[model samples]
Target: MGRFGKLETDVHIKASASKFHEILHKRTHRISNVSTDKVHGVDLLEGEWGEVGSIICWRYFHDGKARVTKERIEAVDKQNNSITFTVIEGDLTEKYKSFKFNIQCIPKEKGSVIHWVLEYEKLHDEIPDSHSMLQFCVEMSKDIDAHLMEGSEEPYHNDISGQKCEALSINKSKKRHVWHCLIFLGLNQNTMGRFGKLETDVHIRASASKLHEIYHERTHHISNVSTDKVHGVDLLEGKWGEVGSIICWRYFQDGKARIAKEKIEAVDKENNLITFTVIEGDLMEKYKSFKFKMQFIPKEKGSVIHWVLEYEKLHDDIPDSHTMLQLCVDVAKDIDAHLMEGSEEP
Candidate 1:
């Protein structure tokens, strides 16, 4: 009769269980395929990988001779996030009576705990302990973890778009950032009217309805003014009184006029902030492309109004859009003045 022997070790890793699982799935074969010398070629045969009932065969040099082992995945449970491998057939069958390896993962605060279980029976009573194999597994786990943490040098699909937009602090809980790129269409020079775009992150300290009221009054008051020296009526309309509303404006330039529109993109009443997006109108027609976003943030002492504009110039002579930016800043200042004066009517 063959007597079973067992060895167990637990290692706590500084990565989440999900991360550990990802590492294991991507880099387990490095542990299974081992070579004794540089001259020896070692490789693992695979079929139906990372699933129950899968099989893996390893071939490598051992004691100056070729050795092979066939392993079968006995069980796999993604919910529990565990797997077990049993040696089904191998050249070492005569030397080792039985062998089984099990790995279990548990989620922890900042990382995960990996439990390794190994069991084997030897043909001879004097057979030595497989401490080297256990050491090999532990070291390989660390290698895989390092690889995953560092990540691959090759760019991923998400990176194709470009690096993530960096965050900027506009307030304690609010952030803002900008994104600008020069495409084949033209350069993003201020003179070209194709300046950079702005994205605002805002957190407000007031209710949604109050913030909406402020946004409506401020935008309406500004649109009513003449954009250029020419006299034209720039009217704003849509779900005029509520969040998720739309506003359109017509501005006179020269003898003719142009129309632009904006849509309420996001609203958080609890946070007292509203974000609006430019969906349609004359701005898009004048520029090859144009879009903007605006956000209103209410604070305990006062509130901040954020504005972002993205546009491409239609011609090289248009000049940069600093005038538009100044217009926005002026509006913000006006609103601030009104708020400080305790006036709700703008």
Candidate 2:
């Protein structure tokens, strides 16, 4: 093979072409969760995500080796239903002088076809083409397709506008197919949707101890800081900051008021960590189980607030807890500002 060559492959997807294309470009960050086996994480390095010329870092596994790459979004053409990325640094640069990835979603009668193209120039003739990397991308596409199709309101159809959907592929058919697949895999449908663990880190100008105190000891006061999101919190059992304490929280999300009854599962003052497990309230209606862990790490200048969410959905139709993670970050930001203002007072 020549030092310069191209690798191409196509994937048949059950998801609509427009939706697949939109996800490939607009929701690139979410691919890591959808294809966790291949993609460990994606982080925005420069510019805004999903925009042309933005830079993103990818941590993935390829050929049984952990790999990392930083690529810049070179093109996003909605008219062609395609997006392109050019590798600027990281592992691939060691062997390849240049590497570029392009993905196009083509609408078809039955479903859609995802076409992946890899253009690269090897450093030397001895270096091999990156067929393995191309294969990895193909598998990731299938994972993304399955994720988009799961719990979607629209039936599988070629129309991008989503006005013309096939009635035969509606919710009933999708549910039956899912049940059949679970049966074949010897899995229980009721216990199967326990799917995601999401983590977020927010850096703030507040001290770790102060932040920890707010969540562990003075949680009821959070409504005063984040007035819009948190209406109030009441202690149901035990004392604040004590393990086994039960609390009820009234919050607003998705433009609606919601409530959650949570118990203090653990408290690690030494590490500035506290854990809460939801036992009752509105969240339980959609989730079989939900839990939250907050840890504050002290730094030279400020602190880092880390939030981890472990949740199990009642069914695949229930969305992942990305919004809840956003809520935690928002609350942290609000509290950080409140503490900074207090310190400035003479």
Candidate 3:
């Protein structure tokens, strides 16, 4: 009953959707090479690499301990750019009755979004949820995205004994084993720290489409809709919803007035998603970088507004963006109430 649960998260990736999906769908064997710190190896045990019914064994580290999982390819939907893996054996089965993983790469107007869903039925209510595992997937995805965008074709080498070796091309006819060790030394030097991500889900009674329309097309109206939080929003360059367009927001945070100059990074109306990257703003005083993404997921009756905040602190003393996250939730709730009132009018 209550022990059965699901956890979901969306990771914003800088890589193209098609490329990211290709790695997951066709190049899964190279995953350990791209994300060497997390995944030690991925071995094909049954069937072919991207085919359904194929079984694979994943050797990796989780929660500071080495773990293994034997998973079967459940589904591969090319049209939607998604894949599903069902765990059939290994360490995960020791505590959970069942566990499944689904990953979807949604193409945006610019960069892509990686949606991860983990479903499991625990043997007992006392068994904790798979939050750490979800986080591991997220971090691993980030590493892979970084590698894809910046890595070169230079082959890395590794040995079966777990030591670094020269990269080799497998010759199946010769019965040569494929040893994948594609490592770009220092490829991720600048990507390690200061960056942060936060997500908050706010449920509402208003239609998800209507809310999305307000934020996507009629963003200037947000100030009017939530006057207490947003004083104004002005288009500084280009057109609304256009990628690379610049805009400025006058808002209240921590009971103090503030402003932020941002550039539109992506706006996918089909998926009800938008992203904003801040270039200049008062908040930039403490943050080296800041970005925001808003996505709406529809439900049977109401819907949920997913807000993601990505930022990097200029220094260690800077606090996390909890207050900014609260501001986003407050403003979204205000707009939701406004939309509901409008729907009931006349």
Candidate 4:
């Protein structure tokens, strides 16, 4: 006879112990056909899961044949988030006289760590080592961990009468048309367009590095070059692009150069969004303050750039910001045309 073999793995999940327990306790179908031979199938044999006496069965493929084994829960401890299952019957008896599997969860910051322990005893010294079985168990444990974590992605469901139920919805009357028109028209009260936009379809395909260089060179006069530019100044300069980074801009408007000072408000690389406050130098002095946000979203082969500007007018007759927004949209079209043209060249 040989000693019992063991295999273990520890993994962290981004969910509470209660949620994890609920997922594990729910009986579900197991793997049927896989590229590997260790796991042939899985089934809930007898009794409900999470109970001390519940039994789970595993059909394994070994030595070119399928073998079935059954395990009964020997212990259940909800407070400690642990469960112990002991092999009670099956073909496993031919190779291993006995087997036990234990799984425990330990609370961690904003998550929990799941530990799997498997112990088995060999029936004879001539039997092959349990390395393959141990490997199979570790992989299966990871799969279970993944399944449990996947449940967290779903919307919360209320459990009533031991069945999961979605929350009830309450309907309300829609707002009157008067309110909608007033809000939209009031915000866009301006009559004249002060900003002009020139859009061209020409391609100007440039690498991120090249674009960063141009942006930095254009806005270097400001305190920080990386956070102020359209493509992100940090690509050219080092990190540390934070709030208060001065952004400089000079654009020709009707043959006159318009200058503005911009202060970085926020940046999120993961989301590819940036916001800044603009202080118009030549014509923006009349406004209390102006703010704008730009977002870059990756698309199929290119990117969609969106710009939103918010400003409070100094005088009621100064006009609304809608015209300026239109001008910005035109400018974006021009930029996109240039980029597309550049991409087709090489």
Candidate 5:
């Protein structure tokens, strides 16, 4: 073998992490029932299912050819929701000297993100990279994600207009989905249209970089990000803090739980800023559109946080964005205090 290759991809899912991890490791053979189009059969050939050193054979079709892949269980880390396997036989052996695959399902507040990795050594330079195999794995991951999302309480991925979106019921039959997660935090206004900014700042004893790290990398640390007022934040389609990615905010507003999906319009790490543009939600009832922008500015000790709402009035008889701004301020302060308190601890 003279060639080596590795590839990694992330698949966003709104399913329970523990549940999906179970399906991936403990009940992998059941995938045939979930998606017959991809997985034909999975047979345990040797030691035991899911245990290290156990050999398993997969009978599947890839790139329009029937293929077999025999893999040995190498490691299973439950705490991290990860599993590893080494290919021992099958069509993969025809082109590779050795192949290792690692799958990790990372849990988020509202869903899970599966990180799939493949490391392989090819037998010759003529053998192409395992692009088709990676695509096969990604499709399989999506199938499992759809199956698990079926069990969530509120399918945040659905079009939560007061009227149930028929498309949802239709997809429910096909065992697939078209929508993803969305979130929103706004107040019902009694007056006409007005623009407002929710500005809140805190002086944490911790450093600026620490404040950013706690928020940027680990947003689940912010308590108010997921709660009664805001159902949850599901990353529908991108990196956590990257621009142009989409996110769904599940919300509990006015005696009802709804979803508002938005796109990440901007991300300025150097300035500690992230902006979300609301594309669809109950807020569409009274407003043409809305944008939520949160920024953290370095202060003397910690950071000065700012939450702004730039929105347009759908009509004239709607409420303003004050209460929503206040809510934003309260949430920001809560996060600041929570972080500050954590910083003072041993």
Candidate 6:
């Protein structure tokens, strides 16, 4: 018998189960709009959506390559908010004898839960379990959930993978480098915590250690700091740029001067992971809490730098972080441009 594996995952999101299932049944084609960077497009291949034996084709970028998948609707249970799709062609077929997805939505005390089950049989013993494939499912569920929740909100793109690389995606599912985040209020509104991860490819990049030094220690010395949305940064307490370090950022936001106090919680020199937790300042006044992290993953062409932010919103009207995130992205762009001009690292 061929090796078989199953992956079951449940995620909670603020949405309606019926609406969620309806999207799965009808709007499967729009996933590309929500996750434009990863899922390039999804097209109807044959038959009709929600009907048994219907076919759908997906075009996506994953792991630095473009890939495709064709699936057939094998089952549907309207009352249970459940549907199943069997992989009849494409990448999964190359190594797997057969694969399918069983999806269900269960209402919860608050919001709803998305339950996914993946059943697959490998063609050979050397084939591995569908761990990444499972992750792909989880990510897809989140994208769909986010899409439903975003109602009327502008579409957003979190970069996926490193530059020149995005994994195969479905209806706005997998991203190469970046991931979406839902701004959340206190625990009452966000029993499920939220965070955002952003990444950029640094051309003419510095080594991880070198990039870490500049990002952590010498950021205050940047000349374009003012133009990049940051006026200045000061080392408030502890050693600068080290674990347990404390720093204060003085910046402009919405035409107002703002300050944030953050402490370095963890640093991994070997893997180039850095974690910072926001402890106080104007940000704490507006946000429940915050954390920022940076990671430097090396690549053959250059390097990939990741900036991650975790924060709880004070209120629903506080406005999404789209502009703030754009500022961070702008800062990175300015830094790289300045570094190239100066012939320096950090």
lDDT of each: 0.50, 0.74, 0.75, 0.49, 0.63, 0.65
lDDT of 3 at 255: 77
Candidate 5, residue 166: CA error in Å? 47
Error of 5 at 259 (Å): 40
Work out the TM-score per prediction. 0.37, 0.51, 0.50, 0.37, 0.45, 0.51
lDDT of 2 by residue, 1-346 (tens): 2366465656666778888888778766667767889987677777886899988888789989988888889999998899999988878877777779988898877667787778777766566546568558767886887788797643232211111111121111111000000000002323433455656566678999999999999999999989999999999999998999999999988789999999999999999999999999998998888999989999998888878788878876675565676677678888988999975311
Worst 10 residues of 6 by lDDT: 171-180
Better of 3 and 6 by TM-score: 6
The root-mean-square deviation over C-alpha atoms between each candidate and the true structure, in angstroms, is 24.1, 18.4, 13.1, 24.0, 19.6, 13.3
User: Which parts of model 2 have CA positions greater than 4 angstroms off?
Assistant: 1-140, 143-193, 343-346
Model 6 lDDT tens row, 286-324: 667677777877777446566666666665444335456
**Residue pairs whose backbone atoms clash in candidate 3:** 157-165, 157-166, 157-167, 158-165
Model 4 is weakest, by summed lDDT over 10 consecutive residues, at 176-185
Off by over 4 Å in 1: 23-47, 59-67, 91-94, 153-346
What residue runs in model 6 are displaced by over 4 Å at the alpha carbon?
A: 1-11, 14-19, 26-206, 223-226, 316-319
Give the CA lDDT, 0 to 100, for residue 214 in model 5.
48
In model 1, what lDDT does residue 114 have? 69
Cα displacement (angstroms), candidate 1, residue 191, comes to: 58
Worst 10 residues of 2 by lDDT: 177-186
Clashes of each: 4, 0, 4, 13, 8, 13
| Preferred candidate (lDDT higher): 4 or 6 | 6
